[model samples]
Target: MSAFEHSSYPEVAKLTIPDVSVAALDMGCLPPVLKRFVEDGAMRMQAPVDFIVVAALCSVGAAIGTSIRVQPKAMDTRYQIVPTLWGAIIGDPSSMKSPSISFALNPIQSLEGEMRIGHKNAELEYKANKKIFDMKLKQVEA
Candidate 1:
């Protein structure tokens, strides 16, 4: 099993987002701004498994169930941030955990029986912040 898996554009690329970020409270050095954002409701933390982040500016792609493979672009080796990612090469819908779509990539492979906001062909814009990245695996039809 790989360390980081995610869903994103460019389905043909394969990337491993580095899960290494300096601690937020490392006062001696640059603050863990990312952790602060996750703590202060400004940003978010990573979820379990191939969960999608249809809510944030950059959505993560995980190859779980019936999903696509996102190829990773080369690293820039400059910017320093939490969860550094190698930009995807191609955008693939398989990266998104669509309940309607089905695949088998690992120990977890099951069909998405129903369609909801955050699952399958679903997405949502939060009532508080009208951001496209506020996607979740729980959505109800209007």
Candidate 2:
């Protein structure tokens, strides 16, 4: 007998999942400059404001690095927290998440490029200086 024609198996009921409700993002919570940037990015890229906001905040945190620290308690210095932030943007495939992240991190990427160039130049200079110093040392020993 064909699988479809078999009547011995019991019918299974379909499962229904309820929709989840999420609170809307409040623009007032963000700084004026950041609010403006997020708004502009959302409008221009046709992306969600939440995505831009999260991306911007993450980028800012990465840029800050571990340079600044905050003591949560006034009296106690034992608990120190770095201002670093990590976040993830979860959405459907065509929700513009990638574009939002790229736009938000543009400034950081530019800075990184500049830093890379500077580092390369410094490395070259160090190598040249080391070569000169080695030559001088050899002459001094002879």
lDDT of each: 0.32, 0.95
Q: Cα lDDT for residue 62, model 1?
A: 36
Residue 115 lDDT, candidate 1, scale 0-100: 32
Prediction-by-prediction clash tally: 33, 0
Give the per-residue lDDT of model 2 (tens digit) for 1-142.
Answer: 9998899988988987669888999999999999999999999999999999999999988998999999989999988998779899999899999999999999899999999999999999999999999999999999
Badly placed stretches (over 4 Å) of model 1 are 1-31, 42-142
Q: Whole-model lDDT for model 1 versus the true structure?
A: 0.32
Worst 10 residues of 2 by lDDT: 13-22
TM-score of 1: 0.13
- Candidate 2 C-alpha error for residue 16, in Å: 5.9
Instruction: Write model 1 residue lDDT over 1-142, tens digit each, in one string.
Output: 3434554444676888779884333323323542333233322222212232122113222323125333344575454334423322223554434421121122123222333324633433344344433443234321
Off by over 4 Å in 2: 1-20
